[model samples]
Target: MEHIVELVGRALLAFLIMMVIARLLGKQTIAQMTYHDFVAAITLGALTANLAFNVQMKIGHMITVLLTFTVIAYLLMILALKNRSLRKWISGQPTMIIQNGKILEGNMRKLKLSLDTLNQELRERNIYNIEEVQFAVLELNGEISILRKPEYLPVTRKDLKLKAGRQWFPIELIMDGKIIQDNLRQNNLTIEWLMSQVQKKGLTIAQVNYAVKSSNGQVYFDRYDDQMPNPIDKE
Candidate 1:
């Protein structure tokens, strides 16, 4: 039990020390991390994490290791600041993943970035189609930056020279076959009125998955299972 407690205590200390070092390094150390920064962060974290639980590694040894690495990192960063070429080498240059709506196959190969990985990243950024992108850059720390074509970008009210701030909000009328009285009262709607609207869509309160009132004064309706039978029934 004492051994376990010691292990936990050492782990906590290691985490705290690393956290302080990271905070001192500033947000740019991770936010706009270069390849070297990324590698350094990971390697340091792994080393500390292992040292925390490894009984063979004393706390003094861990501190010594951390201090040594921190000094080295500080020196490297200072040198990098002084020398542009060193900075470029340490950080690496951003590779063009896509240019002019086409993938740079050579860059992709060099970076070992696969089509699937690119698509996944794009999807996370709400980009559905690759052709919609004008430029895609792979940063040194492996993050992607996308620039979409004008046509692919969502149209803002400013584009049409319109001052429209009164955006529409949807009101929840029902959820999971239960009448949301609070929402109904908030929207100045009644259960009877909601039932009448549901009937218009050939649906019942029991059959509705969600019923919502749109800002355009439209009542949007959804069935519990629109395309197929309820999966809950299968279970």
Candidate 2:
């Protein structure tokens, strides 16, 4: 009974620690993890499992090791974000697999991406004919991004001679009840303006789940309690 209780306690501790560490590590899905991120994830998983089951090892010692590794990994990620060259070195640059309907055999050799695999990826994107590809890049995350030839490209608003609304990158002003000061400053906005906007919406910043400055410099808010009637997902 004591052994079982100890095991359960260890599992719960490991689970909580892993959750906290994962949140601190940032939000990159398995498909988006870079090489370093992948290595860190594997290492962390091993350490977490050992922390739960390795009764021979002292828990404090194992936790210390795990935390130290997490710190190193976090610091590396921060440095990578700030340093473009370092980021490229860590995550690697995208490789051009196809250009102007011509396959880059040498580049594919370097990536070890077989023609069969390339064809498979292209087919998944509904590009059955490689000749239609103007440019196909193998991204660092092992996904292929393809640009169709101009002639093969889909018709857009311009093709129909229709006016289109200008698009802008959405800037986060508030996320998870916290103001994004840097983003606000980047857009030459002030807290007074942000507060006034929130006030107009009958909300305080604390009550907002997220807020963004979108197209035509409009502020969009998503409150924590949306108060929608019968939401589509019904969650």
Candidate 3:
């Protein structure tokens, strides 16, 4: 029917318009959205939805409003970037909630960041013990940035005064029973050497579901039939 065709056309138009506007807006990630960006995003989504289904409004008028709103948001974003005070107001300043293993209850109350939320965020960053946190700041984009006490930090090779081990990048030699000829050639390996490696493990190229050769020249294999009684990860 004509109505169905019109709806389809409008939906496609909405998609194209959103794609263009998104490029113009230059949003890198939803997680990085400021308060103004968040509001603009919601407004854009609503406008696009209306453009898709609200047949009562004139399409030209609908597009005009959407484009106008986007221009205003874009201009505001540009101005926010140039002015430090405006940026601070729009994005909000990062607030420190934890310092020297002590929770700042005053900052928490002012930012309306709940203790439960703080604990959850800390756990997400693998900081199980709050007493060990050296510093924790609530970022503008609702992410918690934490610095652990030096004592709680993981030991590094430099600390032990030991040379770093050879870094070996794994190269795929076989996948889905097919030999990766390009990888073999790049790694200076031949089919004969590959077959011998497979045979050492009492398997053939046909038996391997996947295979990889480490830079250390160690070849590993995975078979088609794992014969697992119960995969622990299966829900």
User: RMSD of each candidate?
Assistant: 9.0, 6.5, 4.8
lDDT string for model 2 (125-208, tens) is: 999998899999988788899999999999999999999988778889999999999998988989999999999999987799
lDDT of 2 at 159: 98
Pairs in steric clash, model 3: none
What lDDT does each candidate get? 0.84, 0.89, 0.89
Native-to-model Cα distance after best TM-score fit, residue 211 in candidate 3, in Å:
10
User: TM-score winner among the candidates?
Assistant: 3
Which ranking of candidates, highest TM-score first? 3, 2, 1
Residue 23 local lDDT, model 1: 79
Residues 4-117 of candidate 3 have per-residue lDDT tens digits of 998999999999999998888886426578888888899999999999999898899999999998998898888788999998987678899998889999999998889999
Candidate with better TM-score, 2 vs 3: 3
Residue 57 shift from truth in candidate 1, angstroms? 3.1
> What residue runs in model 3 are displaced by over 4 Å at the alpha carbon?
165-235
Q: Per-prediction TM-score, please?
A: 0.62, 0.68, 0.72
Error of 1 at 45 (Å): 1.9
- What TM value does model 2 have? 0.68
